[model samples]
Target: MISQDVGTRAISVQNVTKQFGFFNALSNISLDVAPGRFVSLLGPSGCGKTTLMRIIAGLDRQSTGRVVIAGKDLSLTPPHRRPVGLVFQRYALFPHMTVSQNVGFALSLQRVEKKKAANRIGELLEMVQLSAFADRPIDQLSGGQAQRVALARALAAGPPVLLLDEPMSALDLKLRQAMQLELRQLQRSIGATFLFVTHDQDEAMVMSDEIVLMNSGTIVQRGSPEEVYRQPRTLFSAKFLGEANIFTGSLRREGNKSLLQSDVVNVRFDVLGARDTGAGLVCVRPESITIEGASKEMFVGTEPNSVAGQVREAIFQGAFRRYLVQVGEQSIMVQQPVLAGTGDAFSQGDQVLLKWSDQAVAQIEDDTNG
Candidate 1:
């Protein structure tokens, strides 16, 4: 792990592992989150994201490694004693309590005076924009409203860090998306480090300042949304984060350029330059490919990165059309924005030329499973 400045990090996890009998749930997990930043722990099911969050929250202990929050190691601290707040997917607000009561729960536990707790609850409800509903029963609140109350309760103690475990998964898509924005705004406004955990790629991308992508109990990649999405470092990262058109090939360097001979696609690809090519895997996003109707003379040119193909399928989304172009044994996807003269768009059985630039294609390193 790189040496970190103690003052900058709100949470630091170093070489943490959690094992259940012979099964390793987490393997040498190390991550550093800066103060007041929204960082998402993202991965598929059983990837150890929740396990890691539990460890950080002190609900579950790691087999090894140190967990530090706000410059103090919390490895030995109990959940309630730790300087972190937690919100879960199912918040499980007390059905017997009112919204104000729930928001003041932590303050009451801390033995704050009744007047002080009431004032704090009032401030929290105002912050969450639920002051009007402070007296409502928990059983009567909507899913979104309950989540807001849960968030207010978590924030009542003003912990330096907040850990959310798929907090919006219970809401519908529209409400979930709206909550993503609201949660992000709340974190920024409160200036607290938020460690959000989710398996949804779009939610992570929309909410996180940095994404810690996990797979098979290990960190696959960590970066800003654009960096990890557009410049993935591994095959797992490329495929998991978004849609990727993958091609396996043998790489050969020719002077300043590199060419790949694909055994699967039965074609050659020109790459921008040489790279470590023990087993070449290239990834291009569907949106990067441009498709136009192929002419008889189009294949005659010596274009470096063009594929002569025929449209095998086309799907029209609201703003764009998705076309599957068959070039030799490979079928490539191309997405183009809908333009004027919709009747002139490429359709199935239409001959087309597919092309993309060197910058549009990225090389991915094969993972253990690949």
Candidate 2:
């Protein structure tokens, strides 16, 4: 991990809006990335993550707002004049060039000395662990190797900021997973600010120092992966980053606590204030709920944080057992870790009680219509 100074920003985007015809691709988006930090622009496809990256890279101009890269305002600068490197999804490498030639293309454009360019290419190939295949043609390399070549080419100019737009989407699952770690390590070692754009939640979680979640060209939430996952502020943020079981009801105040009453489930949790006292929605993660066998007598007057439900479906995934329990009119998903050499704990058609702590449930806004 790279330590970052919050006092300084490597890339600052202020109130940027990109308009195409009448369709607003990005709407008043603003972001600040610290030096040596890895930030991910995470969202679904067509959510304007790519448009934001293009605007930062100067490939597409923002309709309004300023773009400052490495402390210089470059809103109207051309792509080549910006102090940022770009890695596209398709790589766009020269098929006729070798790995060394591709990695040194930017250096050659600057008219650097031949020996200096060769040394820089050697260093980059070694950094990406492709020194052994430096002479291989672009078409002869594997998907992972090609991606590394593109990364090396992007970093050839030693730009202060690097913009990667789904550079690993073409690789297989296993290779992509492996490269996620590799790319993270590369960013840490190089200490350059990286802005990665991906729709993959897992990818963003594994690699980013911070996650900026966007929806409909607007930022939904921005925080660390664990913070966003554990404390989502809205329904979209809750459901998009991970699986969540939402409980909705009318909210009422009880001293310093808040109680949500519903026919299906009632939740009583501590609240910081009275701002949220109307329509209440709470999100609980599947792994946070515990399941145990229960009888009809145990569910007479249901208590807060406890619910009795029948197991409708039980799946034996390798690492955990996923159970879909039918409670009232809703079905809640619960995951239990599968201990090695232990048999299944609960089977289908069994009665079970699910319980979770109030701290495990996050209060989220009902932004379904937003």
* TM-score quality measure for candidate 1: 0.93
lDDT by residue (tens digit), candidate 2, 1-370: 1124323689988899999999999999989988999999999999999999999999998999988887777888999999889999999999999999999999999999999999999999999999999999888999999999999999999998999999999899999999999999999999999999999999999999999999899999999999999999999999999899998888988777778876677777779653456777888999999998899666622788889999999998988999999987889999989887665479899999999998887888977794
Compute each candidate's TM-score over C-alphas: 0.93, 0.96
lDDT of 1: 0.86
Candidate 1 per-residue lDDT over residues 1-370, each given as its tens digit: 3245854689989899999999999999988899989999999999999999999999999999999888887889999999888899999799999999999899989999998888889999998899999989999999999999999999999999999999999899999999989998999899999999999999999998999999989999999999999887788899898888888777777555566557434224345443735568888888888887777555522465577877889898989999988776788888889878755787889988877787776777889563
What lDDT does each candidate get?
Answer: 0.86, 0.91
Off by over 4 Å in 1: 1-4, 263-278, 296-302, 340-343
Candidate 2 positional error at 195, Å: 0.2
Pairs that collide in candidate 2 are: none
Best by TM-score: 2
Cα lDDT, model 1, residue 369: 66
Q: In candidate 1, what residue range of length 10 has the lowest lDDT sum?
A: 263-272
